[model samples]
Target: MAEVTTSPRTWSPAAAPPHAPHSGGPRWRVVVGSYGFRLTLVVLLALAAAVGILTYGNPAAPGSSGFWVIVRSRFASVGTILVVAFCQGVATVVFHTVTNNRILTPSILGFDALYRVIQTALVFLFGAGTLAATDGLGKIALQSLLMVGFASLLYGWLFTGTKANLHLLLLVGVVLGMGFGSLSTFMQRLLTPSEFDILSARLFGNISASDASYLPWGALVCVVVGTVLWRRRHVLDVVALGRETATSLGVRHQREVLLTLVLVAVLISVSTSMVGPMTFFGFVVAMLTYQVVGDSRHTRTLPMVAAVACATLLGAYFVLRHVFYAAGLVSVIIELAGGLVFLVHLLRKGLR
Candidate 1:
């Protein structure tokens, strides 16, 4: 054999090949290493704690009727919280993915404004007492139908071209939303203080205001719509790549976008009908979700988004209800906090 003189192994650190990136690591390990997993754990623990504190204990005897009643009510409130979180979190994430805009949410599509208009019109036409006496299920159904109908019409008409004018659709939505908002304000201004107060209560996203009666229907809608979105999550990832890319990748870009907006409209209808308009709650949760997950894949990000939203709602509800005993202020506090975060994010982006 020819003198197999192995070249002396390089001992210098500079001569050593760089360590391979851990991209080929076990899937589970990669998942564990990601922020999404850790944050999910934290969120779950916080949610459990919140549920425990909110539902456990009773002034009455443990197994007494009063105790069970209290437990039932707390459970209902928790259910509302979870439902709202799901609708807002999922809707916002999907909306942003489809629109390819991080700053915009379904609220910008006029769902919230439409909700306010319906609510205001209800109060304006029929007295608040009549509105209150209206069947909860009926109200949710009507609201959902109206919203879904309007969105379908708007999107159906605008998205009819070979290339959907998403910008035009968005512009039209913005204009419509502004019009609805203006109408609502005008109606609100015309109302008596008492009526305004009632309408105002309905406007804010308050958990306590949520109807237990609406829970079953709302939960059903959420499950169905959420399942649809979850199943199409990968498609959503493609959609997020923008219309041309998604089209190039064999995605029915316009159709998928239309479907997503319709789903978003349904979700918004459920959540808005259930807990009133949470204009910025979805934005806040979606932003925090992206920050925590650090990934664009819907499968990874959506669950974390739901978790964060749940944790936020539960934690806020717990602290306000248990610690501060100001449960009524939960929505106000959330909106205020979310708005502040939005402003800060905008400022940071501006500075950068």
Candidate 2:
């Protein structure tokens, strides 16, 4: 009888919460609206225009031999420069995104270091004159591929848990670079005065002397890799969201990361092969792109911004090469400027 007494319970539908109001503008819109972003675009475009003028020439005209030669000579260097810009820019941006940091670059991965060591070994073993007399294109390609293989092996090991901490990977890279530097120094110390001159010439870049013969092959490689990046632009943007999130979104993070590293290696090989290694050049360009873009959207920011930044840097170098360095080294000047920028960045970050 006591169980017969039941309490009345109300049946009610679940209430929906209020929808949030629309934000004033999209993130992209806000980013594009910033004055700094506009200034960056203006400056980059101006620099690109200047580079175009510097590179362009009337080859058919009489007394235009030197001008036309510069024009023709830029074929591979132009492609190499653009490829390096885009690859390094995109690579650095993606790298920073993956690691969630802004200051790192492909150089930190030891790709460039490995490249240096390979070049040094080639000279030390085969002698510098041999490399110079040999087919430069074939030699550059061989060295590039070797560097690529080394980078792939390094990445495979690191990503596959060979290294527990990413920092450890960077530390290893730094140590490897130091080792390479030491080896190069020891080799340089042993060279006779004549041998030293030969080696030193092989060790730096001369845009005017850039062999145009390599243009076709370098262009093909850069086009293929650049196309791959462009086609997978969305995937790159997703990868920038970090591994777990990118994986959750159906982006194959590991595969993409490895592919990116390969692409970066290819770009590095092209640039270094064309002009030797220019330390902090990519760092300056990538940092400028980021500061200009104000967001990490690879679709719009990575390649274009990087190209503009590099064109600008190269244009400045072109002018300075003709002006202050008439007979001096362009690489030395670029390295000097880039080094200063690096120092400034370090100081600013340190202060912060």
lDDT tens digits by residue: candidate 1, 1-352: 7887788675776765565444456666888877757776858766685666556545878778888888887877788998999999999999899888888878888988999899899888887776788847887898889999999999999999776788899999999999999999999888889999988888888897677888888889888998898899999999999878998999998889899999999988888888888888999989988877779998888888888888888888888887788888999999999899889989998999
Q: On residues 36-147, what C-alpha lDDT tens digit does candidate 2 reach at each position?
A: 5775665576566445635544455644788766665555555545545555555666666666677777777666666666666667787876766775777888878887
| Ten-residue region with minimum lDDT total, candidate 1 | 15-24
lDDT of all predictions: 0.86, 0.68
Clash list (residue pairs), candidate 1: none
Alpha-carbon TM-score of each model against the true structure: 0.88, 0.77
lDDT of 1 at 120: 91
